[model samples]
Structures are given as C-alpha cells and as structure tokens.
Target: MSVVETLLVFAVIPLAIVLLFAVLTLLPGRAKKARYKPGQPWQYQPVWWEPHPLHGPAAGNHDDGPKAIGSSVYQEPQAIGSGHGSASHGATSHGSTSHGATAHGATSHGATAVGASAAQPAPVSAGPLGGARGTW
Candidate 1:
C-alpha cells in the first residue's frame, strides 16, 4: 500500500475519531444541572449538604390546609378524657388498678380501672441522709 494511504488508514482515521469525541464532550446539550434553592430539598445533594429539618414558607406547596406534601403529619397531644390515648397518665400501667386505689389495696387479684393518678408509684420522701453514697 502507498505511504499516504497507509498513514490515512492508521493515523488520520484515529485522529478524526479523537477530535470528534473532544468536540462532543465540549458541546452544550440538554443535560443541564438542576439548580435547587438554598436550604431546600433536592433530588441529588452532596454528602456534606444537609437540607433543613423544618420546612420554611417557600419550602413546599402548603396551599392545601396546614399539611405539606413532604412534611410530617403532626398530631396534637390527646387530652386525658379523649379516650384516644393515655399519654397524660404518666408511665404505662399494667394489670388492673384504677385511681384512688392504693398500691397495697390494688395488690388484690383480678382488679381493673387503674386510673391516671394510681398508675404512678408514689415518690419517696428525702430522708435526713439526703441520698448518701456508699463506697461498697
């Protein structure tokens, strides 16, 4: 084969291919970066970037009442008589022991109605020692 033809086949073709790839890399296409508002949620964020925990006024579409699309659903604390929950009753109660029922009295078998006041154990009165710490 002629030197020109051989050079064209081996060098010219590979050089053209490399130039074409370079041009394509520099071309501005539809793959533009998505810009997110500061402190707002983003589809892709850097590892160091932390979004705000609480939603701001411009965070999301809150037009539908107080609920937001991505915000957590907040529930008001249930009242004592709401029958929804016993959160106001302090610690959880087990077995049967209603209000006004003393701890010793409720020790009887098969009891119910353990009310809010009776569920919690009575706090011990501080003694003269004032909770002294012992080594052993």
Candidate 2:
C-alpha cells in the first residue's frame, strides 16, 4: 500500500473520530425530563428540596386580587370603614361598626404547623446464611 493511503487509513480515521467525539461532547445535549420517560409508567416523585405542595401559592389559578369580604362589596378604600385602634392599645370596647370591623378576635398571624421528620431506613446486619455455624 502507498504511504499516503496507509497514513490516511490509520491516522486520519482515528483523528476524525476523536474530533467528532470532542465536538459532540462540547455541544449541549438534550435536557433530561424529570416527569415522563419513554416506556416507564408516569410517576410522581416528590423532590425533598422543592417546596411542599401545601404551602405554595394556589396552583394553576393566579387571580390574586383582593375579593369582596363583607357587605358594601365595592366601596372605595376611604368609604369602607374607619380602623379602630387594636386591642394592644387597650381599645377593645369600640362599638361594632359597618362590616362588623373589630380588632377583637383577630387571629395571630405567622403561625405554621411543624413539619414531619423523615425517618431513615434501618441498617442491615451481617448474619450466617449457610444453615448457621457448626450445624452441618
């Protein structure tokens, strides 16, 4: 065989293969889908790092504007009612006003339920498998 042909067959092919492999590694590959795969059944695996579904904002629906609370539903902010001083100011005896506004019975905000602890699996112990020791 000619030296040029031997060089092309032996060196050029391997160099071309290596270059192609490097180019493929440099290019971004397809993103791995977390939800659905080709043949496997659809499964819902909850990731521990993500927010718990309970405390997140209401799903799908995003109309977060304030809604009607009591009667006189569409009144302007000034027309709604006056704010009586809160019970912390020792003013709990304010007469009931329009919309039954009162500082009394106000719920303390910022309270949350303690989350459950995720228990770890027990450790496996080594034991004799072949009919126990000295029984044979």
Q: Model 2 off-target regions past 4 Å?
A: 29-136
User: Which prediction has the highest TM-score against the true structure?
Assistant: 2
Error (Å) of candidate 1 at residue 95 is 71
* Residue 25 lDDT (model 2): 88
TM-score of predicted structure 1: 0.22
Q: Which residue pairs come into collision in candidate 1?
A: 97-114, 98-113, 98-114, 98-115, 99-115
TM-score of each: 0.22, 0.24
Tally clashing residue pairs in candidate 2.
Answer: 0
Per-residue lDDT value at 73 in model 2: 18
How accurate locally is residue 125 in candidate 2, as Cα lDDT from 0 to 100? Answer: 50
